[model samples]
Target: MVPMPEQSPPSATHDVTNQPPPLAPYDASADAALLEGLRREGAGWAEDGVRLLGLRAGGTEAQEWGELANRHEPELRTHDRYGNRVDEVEFHPSWHHLMRTAVAEGLAGTPWAEDRPGAHVARTAGGLVWGHTEAGHGCPISMTYAAVPALRAQPDLAKVYEPLLTSREYEPGLRVPTEKRGLLAGMGMTEKQGGSDVRTNTTVATPTDEPGVYTLRGHKWFTSAPMCDVFLVLAQAPGGLSCFLVPRVLPDGTRNTFRIQRLKDKLGNRSNASSEPEFDRTVAWLVGPEGRGVKTIIEMVNCTRLDCVMSSATLMRKTLVEAGHHTRHRSAFGARLLDQPLMRNVLADLALESEAATTLTLRLAGAADRAVRGDEGERAFRRIATAVGKYWVTKRGPAFTAEALECLGGNG
Candidate 1:
């Protein structure tokens, strides 16, 4: 009553109205360095693919799909309504849309399918573009892409899987590979007992009546993309550690012994499912020769490692674009942040870092193609460059992302 007698209303501030709207219509592949570098490095064949990704990145649909996929993390369904063990991972519709888009865009195994010159470079470029949208889905896409070379070690398996791997469709479910329109491949190598070293892995693979058939008995500490139709798993054989191709559905359409023990609660990559599974006499087909599992899967590992380089470069470029866009709109003091000398220098420095990373990653991608072509120099370069690129680029990624986020100040 005393306050009402003063006849003064409480102060009202429209802070929300004063806030800046989000930046949009950003073409991720329009980076001058990326386009120019791809052209100069003989990967211009991927221009169309990169441009398509640019369009998607700028479009509201793709951005919303990425956001929704992240917002709705995958859920693990170990059983059905009747308590039947299904061991399925359920993802939002957005995740399937993203996966389908990625697969249809040839971001997975198109290079291997086409087998043309500059395939790896083209695929790597496409990967960089697609990876920028949402990184979690890249797991299945990456493993599918990487599995090609390793699958080649077994011609029959390659014959059966290659076509499905390259298909533009993204069929999600636990079904026989022969009945699906498309397929994704997963890998299981790491275990709780041994993270990177497969030497200590104790999962046993017992040979069956069939020459190349075996039964796997052990657990996989990490089986990424559990929804995939097939997994290239490593287990102990009579000849020591070996690689085997394990499928979710058996040949008779019945579910295999593959049991999803639990899904890891990872801090990041929440949109993707990484699970722990126990296998009791899981049916598997031998890949490569006995006792050569490490050597066989090493090809797949190397491919994924190079992908890590491209991914790191892509992350840096994405962060820079976001920061630059924010600075152009936001003002500090009396002038726009973009006009400030210190902020300008910081932005320029970040751009340079991103450009360098892009250049180096694309260069290494080129080296991979040349290495495949039997160029001694490139092969030698790739051997050392892969290790160095993977190490340095990944090492700089976290710091670069942090600095770029800092540019947005409190908004970030």
Candidate 2:
């Protein structure tokens, strides 16, 4: 038996070849399109910050953080060990780290707090840069950013929460609003039977003895960022469908009746938690004039739609970069893939698309900045352009990603 022992097979079959190196450690802000658009759109003051964020986002550490956060996803804790209803969604530590960086970098609602000329434009540039690292965590950040304008509908409520909401501190947990260094907000509009038709919502909000307060009783089908400190919810009030601010914890530090029925099993955005929450006797404060829930929440919606456009552009840019990097290093048919005419054409087309998206996104950010500064013409332009851009850019994302992925062959 010892004499019959055979030699091991050669290891050449396992050797790696023609593989593209990892795409990290590259400067994301080096994009000529983004930098040019930033200056042209009046956000040139933000170039330094955007470059810093771009460096961090493109580093290997941030890349690993994004991978780990998505891989771990979020876990729903509906109850404590003692059978107490906790209704908490626990995220991986990596998720928290990404969130901390985002908040510290003023990627959320900080623009509203700043008195600079191009604060919104700067914030938008920061978002576009940091968002390249991870997309899921941007949900809470965007909601917090959008919540400020809608919150302004009720001046007193805005006074109490706006500062905390716009603060750069990233405090997690359902603490009393006044006690937290900062706060994040979520939205609960789509109901089980209603979906986008919010007017069909059956959630009822009965007035409390205290003026401007009510108790909500209904279920939300898609309540994203369930762990946020507060939510802007739509419910049927005595007057009609109205908007209300629902805090997770009361001022006295008691948890609200935000029953997390279950976490959604989504096809993507796994790191962000979406839930079906039942608001049984959930205390809420009216946000605007009664029977004007749509009008009140539309401000938040418009802001989020702009973010959607930015997000779609981010995905396109990321995928295009990946494809270009892969083709440059990979070889096939006796030469480097990138030098091939067909592959070069594909990459050139993708680059054009990416540049267009980036330019349009930054232009819209400029419009938003002007609109906030009381430019009626800019406001009107944004109202139509945002919706159109969101539709076209987002709709083009899947196809663009698909084409870019095809360039990577099996590796993608």
TM-score of each: 0.95, 0.98
Measured by lDDT, the strongest candidate is: 2
Query: On residues 1-412, what C-alpha lDDT tens digit does candidate 2 reach at each position?
Result: 3586766678844877899889998877878888888888888988999999999998999988999999998999999999999999999999999999999999888999988777877887788778778899999999999999999999999999999989999999878988999999999999989887899999999999999999999999999999999999999999999999999999999999999999999999998999999999999999999999999999999999888988889889888888989999999999999999999999999999999998899989889999999999999999999999999999999999999999999888
TM-score for candidate 2, residues paired by index: 0.98
lDDT of 1 at 190: 90
Q: Which candidate tops TM-score?
A: 2
In model 1, which runs have C-alpha deviations exceeding 4 angstroms?
Answer: 1-12, 15-19
Q: List the RMSD of every prediction in angstroms.
A: 2.5, 1.2
> For candidate 2, which ten residues in a row score worst on lDDT?
1-10
lDDT of 1 by residue, 319-373 (tens): 8988988888888887788899999999999999999998888888888887877
